[model samples]
Target: MIHLEFNSESENEGIARVLAATYMMKFDPTMEEMADVKTAVSEAVTNCIVHGYEDDQGKIFMDISNEGSVLKIVIEDFGVGIPDVKQAMEPMYTTKPDEERTGMGFSFMEAFMDKIEVSSESGKGTRVIMEKKVTGK
Candidate 1:
């Protein structure tokens, strides 16, 4: 398992993607699968930056674990948590409507990852755990 924590900033989204891709490389996934992993990671990190912190300063924690053919990722933030996780997961559900957010972050993550789990506390934080199975290595 590899752990990373960084400022909850938009620029860190790319860092999260690259880290996920690099870790998955050892699994020898196909190009398409790599893309999927990157996209899923990006969405999770973006959520932490945009929604969790809501532009306030905070820290985002990410954990990546590789178990044979499975990769599990957990991204968390100790910021303003979601009040309605179910509603947030739905596509086209954006709290920041004025910012032009597409509200597809969770949808994209679900589409790419095999499984996803989210838990949040109103004033505590939000945690997103996702897993993907890679074959062909």
Candidate 2:
């Protein structure tokens, strides 16, 4: 398993994403798959700060592991959680478009990961878990 933690801040999100992709490489993902995963992972971290944290001070946790044919990634943040998950996951949906959010973060995650599960409580925090099959090249 690989673990990562970063300040739930924007400037630091890129570094956290780089670490996530680097660690995920241990699974021997294909070059094309790696690019997709890297983009998805970076988007996830950005969501933790821009959406989950609302650009406030917070913490983000990432856990990566593999079990048999499944590759799992868990991204947890201690920040404002989504009150309505259904709405949050919708394409082109964003709470802060004024902040320049593409509103495609969750959509990208859904597209990249084979499956995604999310749990969040308003005022508590948010956790996003994604799983994919690893067919190494």
Candidate 3:
């Protein structure tokens, strides 16, 4: 198990990218798979920075590990949680249209990863768990 904590910011995403990069080489994943991992992590961390904490100072807990044959990532944030997860997951569903949010974050995770799970409560917090198989090509 590898543990890393990052601030919810764009600059901090580089750390995430680095982690993904190192993990990819360890697992010998394909370039395409590595790209998916980076993109998915960016989306997850971006959500933590933007909607999770409302662009405020917050900590993003990044849990990365190999689960036998699977690569797992769990990102947890202690910030405003989603009230309507169903609506949020819908394509082009933006709570802040004026902010120009594409509402594609969750969808991208779903598309890029094999399994995705989200749990949140209003005024409590949110946690996103994603898993994908890593196969050398």
Candidate 4:
């Protein structure tokens, strides 16, 4: 298990992705699998910086753990939480329409990970939990 907390900066998103990929090394996943995990991690962290904190300098927490062949990742932010989590996860649903946001963060996470669970409360925060099973490990 590993835990990471970093400022909600765009550069930190890459850091988070690298750290996640490093942690996943123990699972002995292939290049494609690692790439998938990195992409999902990037999206989750980017969401925290872009939407959660709105680039106002907040904190993002990440937790990673592996059990058997399954790897669990949890990304959390304490910024303004989503008012409608279900609506937020819907494809092409972005609050920042003028910013050219594709609103595909959650969609990408869902596509790469075996499972994705999101929880949030208005004015509280948001949590994104994802799990992937590494085969042939």
Go through the candidates in order and give each one's C-alpha lDDT. Answer: 0.91, 0.82, 0.86, 0.91
Q: TM-scores of the models, in the given order? A: 0.96, 0.90, 0.94, 0.96
- What is the C-alpha local distance difference test score of candidate 4? 0.91
Per residue, candidate 2 scores C-alpha lDDT tens digits across 1-137 of 87878787777767766776676676787886777777777888888877777747888999988888577889899788899999999999988878778788889999988998989999888999988886877
Candidate 1 lDDT tens digits, 1-137: 89999998788899989999889888889999999989999988888888888859899999999788899999999989999999999999998889879999999999999999999999999999999999844
Q: Which structure is stronger by lDDT: 1 or 4?
A: 4
User: Which residue pairs come into collision in candidate 4?
Assistant: none
Tens digits of per-residue lDDT, candidate 3, 42-91, equal 88888888888995888889988887768999888889999988888888
Best by lDDT: 4
* Candidate 4 wrong stretches, greater than 4 Å: none
Misplaced by over 4 Å in model 3 are none
**Which ten contiguous residues of candidate 2 have the minimum total lDDT?**
16-25
Lowest-lDDT window of 10 residues in candidate 4? 128-137
Model 2: lDDT to the true structure: 0.82
